[model samples]
Target chain A: MRLELKEVASGYGHRTLIRRISLVVTDGEVLCLLGPNGSGKTTLFKTILGLIRLQGGQILLDGEDISRWPRARLARVMGYIPQAHNPPFPYRVLDVVLMGRTAHLGPTAAPGREDMAVARRAINTLNISHLEDRIYTEISGGERQLVLIARALAQEPRLLIMDEATSALDFGNQLLVLSHIKRLAQMGLAIIMASHFPDHALLYASKVMLLKKGQVYSLGRPEEMVTEENLKSLYGVDVKIIRAELPGCNETRVCVPVCR
Target chain B: MAVARKQGSLTNSLATAEGNYRWREIALTALPLLVFLFSFPLGRYPISPGQLLTILAAKVFPIAPTWPATLETVVFQVRLPRMLAAMLVGAALATAGAAYQGMFKNPLVSPDILGASAGAGFGAALAIYFSLGVVGIQVSSFLFGLLAVGLTWALSSRIRHDPVLILVLAGILMGTLFSSGTSLIKYVADPYDKLPAITFWLMGSLAAIAPRDVWTALVPILVGTLPLYLLRWRLNVLSLGEEEARSLGLDTGRLRLIVILCSTLITAASVAISGMIGWVGLIIPHLARMLVGPNYRELLPAAILIGSAYLLLVDDLARVLTSVEIPLGILTSIIGAPFFLYLLLNARRGWV
Candidate 1:
């Protein structure tokens, strides 16, 4: 699957917060969107997911304009994983994942044996099948994030859109989740994730797009796009980009904030 | 492979839990029937369990009438309609409550949160003030209940920010407005006749429920409950909040409309028949949640059964506890309030 945004403009209710944005994400690719607070990253994602009306331009799914498509149809092609938050009720983990089949089932249908099997497969793929019967509200924050990702996967979509999915996790859990995301991309799922960490983009993102003031500041290969200069301008902060070589691993870039 | 093995072990435990839940569901399904049968022998009329059974069985079989003809009148004409009304109203209010709580994503929400009861109360008060008959009172009450919720929905839609919060706020505003309307009508009504009638009606009871009233409420309650039962699975998705549900391919607007329409229908029908019965809708869903987890598939049915049994038991108490029957609305509040407090203090898990 391929997603193309052509000069897309979007915002809440008549005011365009993000405009003139164009990008392409294809299968087996991880496109990381990095921006500071209020850089219109969330709004842009909402537009792509068709949560809000497209203020201008077109979004094409495999070269087909999908601005007018129904939400159920859009969901069949794309899955959205929002940041992990506790819902009011204590739904079991398996029940949460099975909810992904809503698009696949009839309006009044409950999850059947086939749907449950698909949900279990998604949970197994994330290695969280043991958490299937646990209460979603009782799980750890990082585990909850994985459960949500598994839920998105259960939708059986070609593309996954994640919004700061790992922002709430600890360092180890962050890497654990990012590795799973990278693995998913490698297995031929197109993924677009919004992140606050430039280092994450360097580690897992195939392509990086730096958004500043509702427009793309720079878009290119992560190695070229996640430079110290772009990072400084994007967040209005100075940072040192350090190259490190770990034993039995390729060289990697890490961003360290320069405190005054 | 280790993870798979761990999952296999957990599956066994989960299977046990599922078995337990199945037993609980069976118990819940049988509760209302058991309550209904037991309640038959408890009224002021001295009918023993054996006699009650024989009287009930006599309807299907040709048996010699071993008891007085008045026993059959009390059983069929009086007790039967009242018990059925109690169960029907209980189920309707509780199901509507469960649906509203899920739709609003709040544990504290009740069926009358959208002012259905308050509007119904006002309508009944106005009908009594104008000397309308019982049927007129019920019809007007049902219509006004729908009107109140419709106004809330319309008012909330005009505001674009924080849809759920706006909706709740609009509902509260409408509730207060209609409640004051009821109070105002009560003040001006004839103190000797209409005032007492309005007051008793608002207090809520099934003492006057007839065979016709039961049939009247039954149609709308069943009509309203069918959609909710069919859409029970979607209610879980809806409880995740509007944005998340919509992203998962649910048309949140349409689902919200359906839930509101159905919940309002049931709540209005209940209030129209039983007057302003409070706390049953507010508390019964919570009790059901304690028995079954919040998955609506189980929660809804659990709520319906528990609610039906609960009201029937309460009505039996009202009948036998004293010569003068206590109003059901008052009794539910008397029971529901302190139980709600206990749930608040003892709820270890979040919003069961």
Candidate 2:
């Protein structure tokens, strides 16, 4: 399915934070939304997920207007991986993932064998089978992120939206997750992710949209849109872009800050 | 998935394999049935277990009834209904308590968190002061209990920020309001006839429960309970906080409405029948949680059985341990407060 946003505007309670933004993401494309803090990135993501009311304009999924779709019907077609949260109760990992199938099960129905099979398949696909019975609270942050991804995968959605999914992870875990996210897009899932790092977009994103001061700065292929001047203008920081080549890894550009 | 679930160290002592609590559940179920059977014969009427069995059998199967007419009346008309009322009250309070704890996402919550007990108390006091009969008192209590919660919900829904926090605050306000109203009634009542009756009603008992009161309360209690039972599994998701639940496609507002309605119905029904039986609602669900983990699918049913068994046992002790009847509320508080402290001190054992 293709998600097309036309002149969408959104914010909290009469105050329009983001306005007049248009974008289209199709299957097998990774749309990386790059913005500084308070630049309407989170607000836009919430609007797409229907967590907040839309201020104006229209959102269409596969040529159908989805501006006011029921949350359950919307959930069946779209999956979301929010930032990791500490649950007050310690649910089993498998049970947490099985919640992704809520749209498929009856309101009162327990997870049947078929639903369990689907959950098991998701756990296997995410390589989290070993963590299935473990208490979710006792797991490490990296493991929790993987489990959440497995939960979204269990939903079997065509469109995947993530909000700052890697902002809390360490370097090694961040690379581990970013590569996995790239692979998911390669497997024909349409993905929109907000990230603070432009180098990640340069390395992994098919398209990048830079948001600044509640408006879109630029939108295009990462190679064409991302530049040294734009990075400085977006973040108010001076930086140098260098090509880094390492053994047994692909050559890539890295962003390094320059002190005055 | 590949089944390589080695039981971890943290869960080694308290947790069994998932789905392997079947034996413990069976034991819990058996304890309740034993308590129910034994409770029937332990009342003030001089009847042995064998004699009780004979009376029951003679009734079910038409043999020559060889019991005294007075014994039969005491057994069937008085003791039997009281026993059933005790069981029903206990089960309703405990299950409602469990649902409220999960609904509010706080283990400290009780069935009366929404001013139910206080409202019922005020209503009963008002009824007694005006010389309302038994049914009048019950209906008034039920209606006021609902009114208290309805006021709380209405007040909280107006504010959009931090809805749960506002709801808890509203409940506290309503609780204080109704409790003060009850106190006001007590202060001016004629210290002879109406005051003692109001005091007794507030202390709570199953002494006045007849087959009719049981039938009256039973319908609402069962009507309230069916929704909770059918929707038990969903409670786990609902307890995961509203934003997360909505992300998982749960209609959280609707689910909360249903849960609040059911819990209020059961709580109001029980409090109307027996005055303000305390501790059972707060303590029994915790015991259930300690035995089974926090999965609502298991926890809710476990709570119902344990609550039924516990109140039955407590009622027996209330009658047999004293000459004149001891109030149910006092006994429960005397027992429930210490257990609550213990649970708080050792919260690692599944209170979370």
Candidate 3:
């Protein structure tokens, strides 16, 4: 009774971009997808989120096929955190987060006290409540990324899919966001996040799926599969794996690309 | 820490922003009423305020008629209808402009984004070329305005690209087609009779507004504006752009279609009655946004109030400020462009 994609195929009209991809995501687990560009990472996410039609196989959410579920209902069960976007108008951060409560409200109904309360709770949890009243466009890229995550949290979905969630953040914000991602998993939310950094997967992901050329190359525990040999094959860049101990952080393995 | 205050929701800040101009809003609302009251007697009729009230009351209720019959006619037949038409046209244009700006996600776009003004102008020109009566001209103008927008939508829908870009390109194409049609008709008309009529109508004035014009414009304006005012919050979501709005579970296609339909109705109705009063739709929404923040909930009402009052003031000036009344189309640009430029030059906050 969790998210499962069985032999799923999706693409635009008459052109199949992704074919026969299978993955399972359960509660309290974080699945990090690592891939290069043109590997169909985006098409896979869009298909799972029901943004595009799935041409083959079934997507089961908690034992129910949800490939054709209404978007309004899908919004209740799953939330998507897109890459940071600069809205044309300068909406306040609070207002942007409050938009996450749309599935709970009717078409013409304004967000009520209850909905605002939920939004406020999400902002507080992200520890960026100081940004609630600031103009969203004027904020830094890192802050915008956090605000997007907070907005997804406000939706209170069972599964959260994040596309490049931490790529835009500064180093400190990267760590903070990684910790938050781990904390959300601890709270029993299933998370599937696409990431460029395999080190992030090593630090936070319970399962890592390495995608290559529109198919899964490897899927297993990060420590077992993220060897120096595999990363070099995946990215065409020579890389070295090292165990490092740093102050205030546990002794952990890190992936370092070997310079030519 | 300082983040979590004792306040309950986001409305607390919104309430404070409203409080910033509580008295101002009251004054703006009262401005229309004051103009309506003082306007009754200040015309060529020269009726006093007391007589104006008595005449108005006598019309509405079965009271003892103390006012002169001529005064009653002036109050009911001439001043009342013109004043109502001016206010309605102003309010309609302003609200529709604000809606278009929000929906298209660009502050520069006005209600004419769908080519409503050009289409209506061409329709009026064609009617004049045929020597149609006043009512026939207005009806034809209103229908053609809708037709132009419908054509734009139809063409744009076939492309399926970025919705805003496609709609805008189609609108420009249709706008050019209709406006050139108006020009062709102008060239062929009798220089003395038809050209002057088309030119004056295009220049725009509320000087000859009749009660029937008011009645025809009011129904569509009210009907169109109700949905926009009620669903204004949805506009915030829409202004986020289509992809983001869809990710938030909003039906962007349906919401956009409704907004275009309502805005098209109001713009066509106003242009039909008042001709091409150009800047009310473009500038009033900007002024409203500066006064209130970009929150559509407050922005829409603010535009309506300020627009009605601003146009009413301009129409009053058109009546008494000169021996020969200046057209509203000319006056609006003369007044609006400088004020807008001043805002741009000495801007404290970015309008976006």
Candidate 4:
């Protein structure tokens, strides 16, 4: 799967928040988006996901225009994992995952035994099969995040879009989820993720895109694009990038903010 | 491999859950039938269980007439239509309420959140003030009910902001508007006749339900319910909120419109026949949720069965508890309020 955006622009009706953003992601690649609040990271994502109308340019999948495709067709190809939030009803976890099969089912059809198998496969992939029968509302935050990811996987999508999926989890859970994301990429799923942490991008992203003032500031390999200068300019904060070598581990880069 | 082993265990647990769910469905399916059978012997005429069975079986079998013709009249004419009407109205209101609650993503929402009841009440009041006959009153009530929700939908559509919030606010505004219209009609109505008639209609009752009323309400109720039943799975996705549902490839706008249209049709038809029977729509869905969990696949059917039994039982009490027949609206409120309070206290067990 290949997703290419050519000079794409979008925003709320008649107000352009982001423009001139062009990027490409293919199978087995993870592209991480880094931006400050209101910097159009969400707008760019919404545009790509066809949640909002495109103001200009075109989005193509495998060199075919997809801007005019129906929402169900788009969803079949691109799965979305939203930030975890509570719904009003107490749906079981398996039921929650089964909702991802909506795009595949007919307008009036319910999920069948085959769809249930797909949902169960998604749960197993997330290693949360034990939580299948538990009430979704009663689960912990990290567990809920994993459930959301499993829901996306149930869509059987080739390209996955996540909106700060780990922003609310604890540090250890964040790493756990990120590692799972890396494994999914290894399985040949194309992934696009928005992140607040540069270290997360550094650790998991094969490619990184930096957005500032509603435009792409840079886009390249994570090591080349995520820098101390870029971080300072993006968030207007002083920061240091350090490579630490720990015993029984490879050298890893970490971002450290310097306090005045 | 470990994950695959766990998946096997998960399937076993799911099979157990499916078994339990089927049992609950069986119980729910039986409740209304049991209540329907048990209710025949409880009315004012005092038909014994053997007599009730004899009367019911005589229609199918070649049994000779062992009971008076009046017993047949009371059984067929009086109890049967009223009981059927009670179940129909109850099931319709509850189904509409469940759909509305899911669409609006608020468990507190009821079938009349979009002003269908208030609009129908105003129509009945106006028809009474003008001395319209029974058919005219029902027709006017049903049309005005549709009109009020239509107006709310139109008003909300004109605004481009938060769709759900705008829709709810517009519904409230329409509800207040029509309710005031009803009050204004009441103020001008003749105090001797029209005022009491209007007041009684607003308080809601099933005392005048004829056999035709049952047939009259059945068409719209089935029309509305079948679609909702077919779309039950989507309602679950919809309850996840608008953006999530949309990203999952649902056209949220279209689904919301269908839900609103169907719910309005059934609610108007119900209010047209039974007057403004309240609390059934508001509380029966919650009761059903408590019984069967919140999967709409099961929730809708459970709600229908429980609602039918609930209203049948309440109507039975209304018929025999006192010399004067209590309005169903009052009885449902009197009963529903305390039960709702209990639900609120134990909300975590059943709801989020």
DockQ of each two-chain model: 0.82, 0.50, 0.56, 0.70
lDDT, candidate 1, equals 0.92
Off by over 4 Å in 2: A247-250, B1-19
TM-score of chain B of 1: 0.95
Chain A, candidate 2, TM-score of: 0.96
Runs in model 3 deviating more than 4 A are A245-251, B1-28, B41-45, B60-68
Whole-model Cα lDDT of every candidate shown, in order:
0.92, 0.87, 0.87, 0.92
lDDT of 2 by residue, B314-347 (tens): 8898889988999989899998999889877876
TM-score preference between candidates 3 and 4, better one: 4
**Per-residue lDDT of A198-231 in model 3, one digit per residue for the tens?**
8988999999999888888889898888888889
Native contacts present in each candidate (fraction): 0.79, 0.44, 0.40, 0.80
Question: How accurate locally is residue A243 in candidate 2, as Cα lDDT from 0 to 100?
Answer: 81
Model 1 lDDT tens row, A154-207: 899999999999999999999999999999999999999999999999999999
lDDT sort, best first? 4, 1, 2, 3
User: What's the candidate order when arranged by decreasing TM-score?
Assistant: 1, 4, 2, 3
Q: What is the interface RMSD of each candidate, in Å?
A: 0.7, 1.9, 1.6, 1.4
Specify the poorest-scoring 10-residue window by lDDT in model 1 chain A: A68-77
- Winning candidate number (DockQ): 1
TM-score of each: 0.97, 0.94, 0.93, 0.96
Candidate 3 lDDT tens digits, B1-352: 3456645445697788778779777876787788776665665657777777677677679999865677777777788898889899999999999999989998888888889999999999999999998988899999999999999999999995788899999999999999999999999999999999999998988888888899999999998999999889889888988766777777788889999999999999999999999888888888877777688877899899888988888888888777888998889988988988886776455663
Worst-scoring 10-residue span by lDDT in model 2 chain B: B1-10
